[model samples]
Target: MTSFRVKSEGRFVAAGCALIALFALIGAPVIAQEANMLQAPAGMKPSGSVPESLKSDSSSATLAPADETGPRRIVPPGYGATTPSSGMPQAEEPAGPSQFFPAGKRASEPSVRMLSAVPGQDNSGIQIGTLTGVDASTAGLISEQQGGLGADMWQGASRADIDRYLSRLPVPVRSPVMNDLARRLLLTGAQPPEGASGGVSLLAIRLNRLIAAGQTQAALDLGAAAGNERSPAVAAGIARAALAQGDDRLACDALKDIPPGNDPAHDAMAAFSVKLSAYCQIAAGNTEIASLTLDLAREEGMDDALFYSLASEAAAGITLRAPEPNKLTIVDTAFYRLADRELPENAVEIVEPALLQSMLADPSVSDEMKVAAAERAAAYGLLDGRDLAAYYRKPSFTPEQMAGLLTSDIPESSSLRRAMIFQSIGMAAAADERIHLFKLAFATAESAGLYYPTVEALYPELDRMVPSDALRPLAPAAVRAFIAIGERSRAQDWLSLISSGGQMLGRDARELTGLMRVSGGSPQSFDSEKASAEIVSDLKSGVRATQLYAASEAMMLEALGFQLTPAVWDALLDARGALTGDVPPEALLNRLQASGQKNAIGETVLLSLDAIGQKGPGAVHPRASAQAVASLKAVNLESEARRLALEALMARSNAGRG
Candidate 1:
């Protein structure tokens, strides 16, 4: 018992090394030993150095609670803690980006995977390849806006958020804080230490402040220096802010600073910057700009999030906010298209927006194609969904009537030309309502480009024709959405939407067409055109195109699990060709497969082989089994046996005959 008492006292003496000598000099009250200290010391040898009696945790020796309550070992002014307490809460949440970081926080590792979702669970989307992105600008702005800015600087933060949560200095429109942080950033050299999170935090704070203060130059410098170190959210915000300011240059500069090595974030930043640049340039009236900003955004080749955003934007103008605006975002979906150039009668002043986006991205698309595509997109953009395919009800116009107003700048809409005009003409009719005719005629006459109808001019024409009732203009899905939302009315909205979409509605052929086989100007097989055709063919067979499109569209998606395959499309086409002497299945499949995609002709070959097997080895194609078996085997498909077996049964039916 006496030995146990002596050991407990020794631990208390050793517990407060820094405090021990000082307490004695102040003549402070002697500290009492607690039950916790009464246990065996950490790392004490089991080799019997200490008495076996002291090893037991049942020691009765204990110090009474201090009678003279002096300052505790580590207490606040009101804190009464002397010894560690027990039975505390088990689970605890740790402070992170929004909390305090340690000194040299820039070097401190941030938890890319946070535990905000649930206990013992994680949903960190952060990838090893995408780490080191900048978030300081965003973090600083968050602190500034939420009134938590002072908390960071005052109490210091962890190494995770941005290094040091300091206040950002204000800068101007052209200057970013790049110069200010340059020395410090350089002093740390190429690599930061483990706890340099403070530096990262300070850099972010400075960046956000400069951006808010309109110091674009400094922001640009900071962005460049940070390189691919910013987070996706941060890069996106900076790009957006730059664009909102109408400074395309700064936006582009900021985007370039995003490390090229970043995964989706860099691509996301690129998509935003490229789209904005194209729109801003066009807005400034660069009607004839012959380069490609929109194209780069499309094929940024990363950032799926950005891709969806851009596509959504492209569909926005025509299909603004209808429940399903995209349903009408097509030339065939337009009303009042012109027959000559294959435009909707309502289309006016939209030629440049459509045609120019592609020309700006890739200069090689034929002038004729650019003009046609632009017209289609513009027509779709201008259309009102309530009356999709309602052009037949619209009264027809005389050739002279059209030529009297036909302008030189009218751009052609590619495949959409025929469908859009056909739909428009279908909707034309001799409705006695004066407003109806006026709306159609007025829409027909206004031609700044592909998609525009002047209400002022059209109203008078309608009054001249029917001269009764009011005209109503409800665009096809998305187009109507824009009208209802007045999206085009606002300069900012127009710019934002335009920058957001320009290529969202583009035909895959447009993208693929650019990768031309120069020898004969054939579309590169891997382009959007082949994918669209194959996908469409699959859908036209009764399935909606969207479902089967997943195979060709999503790179990671598996081929359709259904028995049907793209070969079916080619085989049908081939049979149609062979029967009509138009295109043989074998010839067509072989050609189409080259640029269209694998398995494009797989089903066709399968059917052909099955037919051959039924013909008892005299199949027209003669090599169906080999073709089907080979392709199926490559995908680990066991359906090969089925194709061969089905052929055996067909042979008995004698399909070899007509």
Candidate 2:
């Protein structure tokens, strides 16, 4: 019985051992997964202590102290822990799963691990760098090498002074040389004047002046070069100029760049933005938005009846007979074009010369109107001479008008008369007849105070004609016209014809010689004594206007480095009695001298324009003209100074004749 019991006990122990082994095998994977959950991923640092429930209780399964300095073993739950006994074999805890799977397992799937956010950290309003101001005065489309004033142009002047001078610059500058100078000054990329706050006020003034002066293309170019399209004032100017140029797309893009709540300070500009925004929306086919914008503009107190009427008409595809405003701004003119409405008969009378430029190409206008518009535009230096010449060629004349052009009573309509003369000159078979027509054209234009425009239109035609003996009697006027347009080489050619034709001692020859000398030419028969005597006679006996003209002639000659006799200088002082109406202020002359002495190029230019005033170089006092020329010379602008002097001479001479 004892033997049987021992055997049974042994059998029972074996069964229990078998059961324990089966339970261990089943729990191994669960324990391994739990260990993985507790262990840190391959790149992450392990944190927190093993769970108390999973800690081994056996004293021999010792864990290293939490504060121990050396590397500690990470034992998984259910594993017996032991310190490393010298030379005893010990198992290393299993490493975390391999980051790179074996080749076959790589194709199983890819997994993404999302990280948790750190506590109490703020990620709002994070910026990379500090913001700073832009130097807007450095903006320009022209470089110094391309005839711009240098970048240092405004270096010595104050911002306030620059702003004042720029504001004073004449709109529709009638003198071509002054017009050119004004454009160059406005477009030059120069340093900001002293005391500038890095704002665009100075630039805005320049752009506005350019737009007001019919230099819309220049204003557009300058605004683009400035890279300040985001500024409301600049964008407004650009939009207006673009509209004036008939580029609705460009205007829309400019208006769109203006940020909300940054409208310009001027009422006109603010109104312009509000009205043009609606127009742009309509142009872009966003009719609903256009309506909303127009409504918003009205609600905001934009009181431009012309614009609203035009915009409403455009939106509804119907004509609203809007009465012409007393003063037509560029925006009004552009909208008038968009609405396809005919301008009033007195449109030219009320509109600025700058606005007249748009009508030159409008097919709806009569040819007579275009000619009249081109004449005014050309006179204001807004239209190119070649363009005016082209307009002169547009009118079709009847055979009767052509046959009686010179002989018939002059047409009542000045436009028809000028066009007939221009066409007749082109058709005349004889040189004398052509030359006579040329004289007649100039004389006809002169009678109406349109001499300069006539000169510009007919210069190219006269320039193409080769000078000869037969044309000598007519050569003096041609020479004068050539000199007026700065075609000195061509003028010299005609002067040679007069000299070779043996008319050197005639009144025309003496006058031509003096003019040529004053315009920087070296004519063959220039008699300084004879010219001086004639000038003195005019200054002594001529009317107050004629005396002023003679005095200006003497001053210009002296300015061009011609040493007129002392009597001429004394005569100029005598002629000062004739100075009436508006004269350049003494303070302005002082400031101009100061600017010149400092070599402040831009300041000198502005002050010079001011000294010349609205009526231009011809109408200003002789002292003003001479001072302007001298100041310009002081700044090393010899070419400009010479040209200014020549224009003054020509303009005064024309005024004398009139």
Candidate 3:
């Protein structure tokens, strides 16, 4: 629970920081805080401090009134049932990016510059002239559009509402400001202000805002403080919010008002509440109470699809000791999953091997859970390569799913065991799953330090795995893996298939495959500009971090050669910048100059590298450092090349530790 609070607070604080940064970029003036601004709901304080009030029985506190007839609907501004209409005028939403982040502002202008060298001048020969001024006021808005906490926080929240709230602040704090603003706005609209006993609409709105901001503790505390308005509707709302945030204890506390009872409503809401209550009980470790609660729900007329579907999660963990009455039934698939969770131990009465095989074949059981069961069997020395083979031979799971599951939760050391399991099973997998599984086996093998056996089993399937002509474009990754593992023949086979089918590899993929071919007399090749563009595409497409790191590593390997492509050159420069504190400038300069020999990369690259190395601004607009070193070496000026290399290394070392 302490750790949970720490983690939750961290998440909220991070969100708050993002909001603050967004507000700063938008030119929103920060408001000074009154003493009350620092106040938050009990238990919502930063980690390491707990309010004594929260330490008490939180559910016993007053709650906002609930309407048993139906959920509360917040009346829009200007439509009040009790007080005279305030008639708040609605502001039309911003219609375009310009409305929010205005253009033509001083910061929104752009500038251009031109560079030329006076013929045969020394290092000082080149001059850069500004051709245009630059404005960047719209830059912040464009970045926000790209996605961050600012975007997520602003989502579904009206800009008008936020602006009104901000205008009231003397100086806004970060994320907590959003929560406070939400509370203030809700209260401002409440017909009977703060102290008055009214409907739960204000409380509901505030709690919703808190929940959206991931400030669940504040929401729970606020729900408990709503005095006379506390009702089943309000309590249920708070409980639902708690459950959504994974606070089972808070949810259980909120739902206590709606205890299990006979003659529950036959409608969907009642059914859903009943199901939620049961799960809440289970989560709170009151298994017997949960079981009874679930039974009572079934006893009522709650057979709707929505109720059943929500009930499935709890049903998946329930253990039935004895057969129950038919009326107490639930979806069978859910019950089977519950049984599967306990696996070999629960299935002790069943025979070996078959039990393990059945566990894999069961669709309701997740691959992750199955992996756990297999690991458990392994711990007891009962797991066999044969049983593993059976899991793959039957083909209920895909290689990608299994790989993801195996890696998702386990310790790094367990990856060794995973490698062993894959090696055992790869040979027996059906053709459809074989290549993918072998690839997984190969990838994990390196980490396990058991590369040979994994590759030995994988080599045979290489040709068979290459997709047909139209699909060749998609198998570059498969080919790259073969090259990485030194299976040159298989790599060639796949490349030939791709070529025969008349498909072109993506630039990065082509360059990578070319690196493999370079060992077989094909020239080492790369396009630095194309590589950088490809990297941006990968980032935009949300490629996983692991994949990005692999790509970066490949670029670094290519940078080792004398001819630096734009991509490789930039990657090396970035790497050098990243490694600044780790390696001294002098050592790097010595290494680059000592290794110098050049082909394609030119003088502009050397000049940039020289400037960067010397802690000076680079003169070039487009390319960078390693290109300069290679370019210098290409012109047969070994002495100049070495000096520039040394300078670049020194500058790199002075940069921040990556």
Candidate 1: what lDDT? 0.26
Q: Which pairs of residues have clashing backbones in candidate 2?
A: none
On lDDT, the stronger of 1 and 3 is: 3
lDDT of 1 by residue, 1-658 (tens): 0000001111111111110112222233432232111111233222213222112243322110023353221001121212111222223222212101001101122222211111011231111111233333322211222211121221221233223212322121110111112112211211211233432233444445444432333343444445444553345445544443333333333332333221224654344433433333232222112022233333344433322322233322211121112221112111101001122222222322212222212343333343343333333222221222232223344455333322312333222332233333334564433323333332332222222222211222222332122221211111222221222222122222222245422222221211111111212233444444544453344432222222222111112122223444343333332211111245423322221123322222222222232112213331232233333333333332223322221221211011
Off by over 4 Å in 1: 1-194, 198-201, 209-239, 259-658
State the lDDT at 404 in candidate 1: 34
List CA RMSD, all candidates.
32.7, 33.0, 26.1
Question: By lDDT, highest first, what's the ranking?
Answer: 2, 3, 1
- Tell me the tens digit of each residue's lDDT in model 3 across 264-366: 5554435545655545433433344444444445546555433333333343332223221122112122222222222222332232221332344446445
Give the Å error, residue 510, model 1.
75
Q: Lowest summed-lDDT stretch of 10 residues in model 1? A: 1-10
Model 3 per-residue lDDT at 418: 59
Candidate 3 structure, TM-score to reference = 0.25
| lDDT of each candidate versus the true structure | 0.26, 0.61, 0.34
Residue 610 in model 3: lDDT? 34
Q: Give me the candidate number with maximum TM-score.
A: 2
Q: Taking the candidates one at a time, how many backbone clashes does each contain?
A: 109, 0, 35
